[model samples]
Target: MTASGRSAALYRTVWRWHFWAGLIVAPFLLVLATTGAIYLFNDELNDAVYPELRFVPPAARTVPVSRMIGAALTAHPGAVSRVDLPAAPDRPAVVFVAPAGGGEPLRVSVDPGSGRVLGSLVYARTLVAWAEELHGSLMIGTVGDRIVELAACWTLVLLVTGAILWCPRGRWRAAGVLWPRLTGTGRRFWRELHGPVGLWTGALIGFLILTGLPWAGVSGDLLQRGSAALGVGYPASFRTHAAPESLPMKTALGTAPWTLEAAPMPRSHAGHAGHEAPLPTDDAGAIAGVDRVTALLAAEGMTGGYRLFLPGDATGVYTAYTYPDRPEGQRTIYVDRYRFARIGPEVRFADYGWVGRATELGVQIHMGNYFGRANQLLMLVPCVGIWLLVVSGVAMWWKRRPRGRVGAPPPISGTRFAGLVAALAVAGAVLPLFGASLLVLGAADLLAGMWRGRVGDAAASGIG
Candidate 1:
């Protein structure tokens, strides 16, 4: 093929891939962008929507943490599973309680000064929680999680193919290539809007996808297993020789740091045989444990709000977890219920390996926790831009599509086709879910082509 011919074939091949990937994942991308944009300001949004439950008047004097827990437990019928100390004097303390009879956990808000139960409700029913469920799992459990992961993987494909198609040919000018040509109409106008907007937002979109993948089902699992195999997983200091047969942090505690969710829970040696112990089994004992840990954390300069997950059983340990607005302030410490010694070394951001630290920082930025309001606004740009890109893409397709046909880019043939297929196969190997869906879609496309060819042949013979 001539140089021009090769260039044309490349563009056509890239366009075909971009078109199919976008068409498949556009709705999912829209849903993700919308939910993510809302979740960026989850705390602020929750405060606004439920001020009674989330805020309190600033006071010079505040009640003890034990009093807050006691008030919440008395008001709600459950064991106090975890308590979140307010970040500020003006914010209410939140206590999560699991019912003795078994049911959804309740989040109780308490006034800091008076130890009054401000309000209580099911945690899962909260707006922010609902949004998170939808974003992560579409509220449909594991199946939804897989679907979201697949969409995320294909989104990477879309970005790569889009970038290839966006490459400038001939003279790179400011008109249609650099900026949208607003003066044009119909397909021309939509094309200008789509290409330039995509070019501007593509890198940010790719970053978001890459960062978000650590939370995905398949990819996240792969990352964890891979990191563990390489011995760069959670810090070794976070683990102890004696592993407790306790629930995972996510199960025992309502929320935990992402890196430590799967890490084994350290056993409390307090009540174990031949162990020096003053195990706390009663409410008062639990309260004293909370007091001791709270003071210890404060003395150690662990500030900016922390959660204390109360020991559930005799073997259970008190877990103090705090993921502050700053990534560097992230801390997770487990204290033996009776003996009250640290379970393992205090797990902090500094303890993470380079890969773990990078993932944590990226997640912080992705979730708008790194720089607060400025970070939220900066992240919002790509989210809103993605919505616009989806709209412009659909509009362009609508304007240029034929009367009764799907307007996919023309298929390539011979070597170009084989190369594109191989590229997709490689992508699939890296992203299993995306690769699986790619195979299914490719099969469907092939079968559809065969069916159409048979129909055309039959019609031609009849005409003859």
Candidate 2:
């Protein structure tokens, strides 16, 4: 082929793959972008919407964490529990306790001053929880989760390929390409916004892909390894534990939503773990006297509302995570409940290894948590950009759809299908979602090829 022909062929191939990627994944992207935008400020929104449950009296003296836990336990008998301390001095300490009958998770909000139950709400809060459930799992368990993961992974590819296709052709200048002319018809208007907005938000979408892929099970592990190689480390404080079986009704309260139910505790062998002595029961009176940890926190400028969590198990330790805007500072720190000596701090931007820092920063940017309210507003740009991309992608696909009836063999070999297939395969192999999609596409292609071959044979036989 001539040079001109070769260039045309390359462009056609890129366009075909780009079109298919956008067509198949746009709805998924829409779901993700929209849901992610809502979730970006979930903490802020939750606080605003549920002020009564989230906030407490400014004049009240905060109660001990143990006392709050005790109160939560008293409310729900035989419930596995986990407590989330309020991030502010004037907010209620909320505990989620799981019930024995597999009922809805219980949320108990307690006033820190009087040790009195302030209010309780279920884990589900109507629309907010609905959005969360849809965003997190699509309410479809592992299958739905995997599907969303695949869509999220491939969205990066869509962004890249879309950007390439958006490159201006002929007389189209960079300015025209990057911004709408405002004088165009419906199609041109959509096209202009589609390209520039996508181009602008491409980085954020890519960041989302990187951060999101870490939840895709094996794929996530692989991504984590790659991140580690680049110097990223997992947050040490983000440890998972199996809940103890048959925990005391008191001990188990306030653990439900966080624990996923009571788990089988790891057994210690013979002399290593067997203790004839009874487990230390919660002495609320003794807990009240531990002034060292609270004083240290206060001295560190962490005055006011914070819960000092007491780990119920042998491996557990007391922990506290301060609110971002609060006086205690935005960092997460843990202290031993007994000794009150600081054990360690949870992962923060400063704590990241080189790659970990990049990852955290990227995620922070994506989540709108890095630069306060300004960052939150800045994120809206990309969220809207992604939504526009999805809309335009669907428009482009619809505009180019074949006019012929359904089930017709698609026109091929005109668009360098080989090159398109190769590019797609490369992307699919690296991205988990693309890989799964390729498998589905392969099955469809095989069936189509077989059907076409049979049709050709029948026509040839009739001619003979």
Candidate 3:
């Protein structure tokens, strides 16, 4: 084939792969983008939704953490329960203690002043949970999760390839190529749908795709390697050898370089048989429950603002992660339900693994939480842009289908093929999902060429 012919063939090959991948994943991608957009304002939205549950103050002579625990156990006798402490200063202190074997946790909002159970409710209105499920896995569990991960990582290849196709080689109309000049209905509609939208939303969607892949189990390893290359220290060592006592929650909280921080309360992981007291074994009133924790925080004057995570299993410690400012500046503290003493090592945002830190910062950026509302509002432009890219991509594919009985053209020249191969290789190194996809694309292309070659041979034989 001639040089120009080869270039066009190469472009078609890439376009084919990009087209198929986008079509298969477009619906899921849209779901992810939409849910993600909603999640971006979770802080503001959640507050507005449940102001009553969140807006409690520290009253004088608040009940003790120990007393609160006793009260929760009394409320739900013979239940294996945990408590989630409110991290924010404005939010009320809630205890979540569920019964063993069945039923939901008893969620009670305590007055903290008299250990009075102010109101009881379930942990419902879980929009964030729903958003997370849709965004992460499309509500399809592991397989769905893997597909999303692969799609996000491969999207970079699609973006790069699409841009190449969009740039007309010699017949480049500057305005048409770069900016959409809406002269007629066709131009105006196409420009509105594709031209301007792609330009504006590219970076935002790119950020989302890049940051999101790391959370996928498939690309997690590649993300870590990339993070290490960027001079950020990803966690190289697991804390298996370190004793639970060695890592106190107070020490972790102190790592945050914040002005005001709370001290962790007395707490312990159940069945961790190492240092202190025997695990509490009373039928109804053995361990200090959630109410006691709220009161203790108030009594100790640790009430600038705080959050509490209820212990999950029998062995988990009730963790308290505190944030004074909305964006930066956070501290973490833990308390043992059984002992009512502090547990685990203290750590800060910066102290987390490199991937963890990046994910945190990325989340902050995604939410417009880092700077303020102004920054958040500015991000809406990019979000809309991303939606446009997905939509236009589908339209372009639909418009390009063959009219007659013509099959796909032959494979491109080796040189152009080599360029695509190289691109895929580099992308794979940064994200394993992309790396794996390159292999899949190559195999698919080779098979297609083989099938076409055989058809040509049969046709030639018939003519002879």
Q: What is the lDDT of every predicted structure here?
A: 0.80, 0.60, 0.58
Query: How much does each candidate deviate from the true structure in C-alpha RMSD?
Result: 3.7, 6.3, 6.2
Report the lDDT tens digits of candidate 2 across residue range 1-464.
Answer: 78777776666756665676676677777777777788778877778877777777864467776667677768764343345656566777776666545667777888877788876777676456766667767878788788788777667667667777877667777754777555665666677667877777888777777766655654655666565445455443332222223232123323211111112222221123322222322444334433465676677665554544444444444445443432113354555555656654443445544555454455566667777888788877777887777787566555545676222224354344466677777877777566787798779977988888888999989953
- Arrange candidates by TM-score, highest first: which order? 1, 2, 3
Best by lDDT: 1
- The best candidate by TM-score is 1
For each candidate, how many residue pairs have backbone atoms clashing (under 3 Å)? 0, 12, 30
Local lDDT at 232 for model 3: 53
Score every model by TM-score: 0.90, 0.75, 0.74
Cα misplacement distance, residue 25 of candidate 3 (Å):
2.2
RMSD of 3: 6.2
Off by over 4 Å in 1: 99-103, 239-247, 270-284, 417-423, 445-464
Ranking 1 against 2 by lDDT, winner: 1
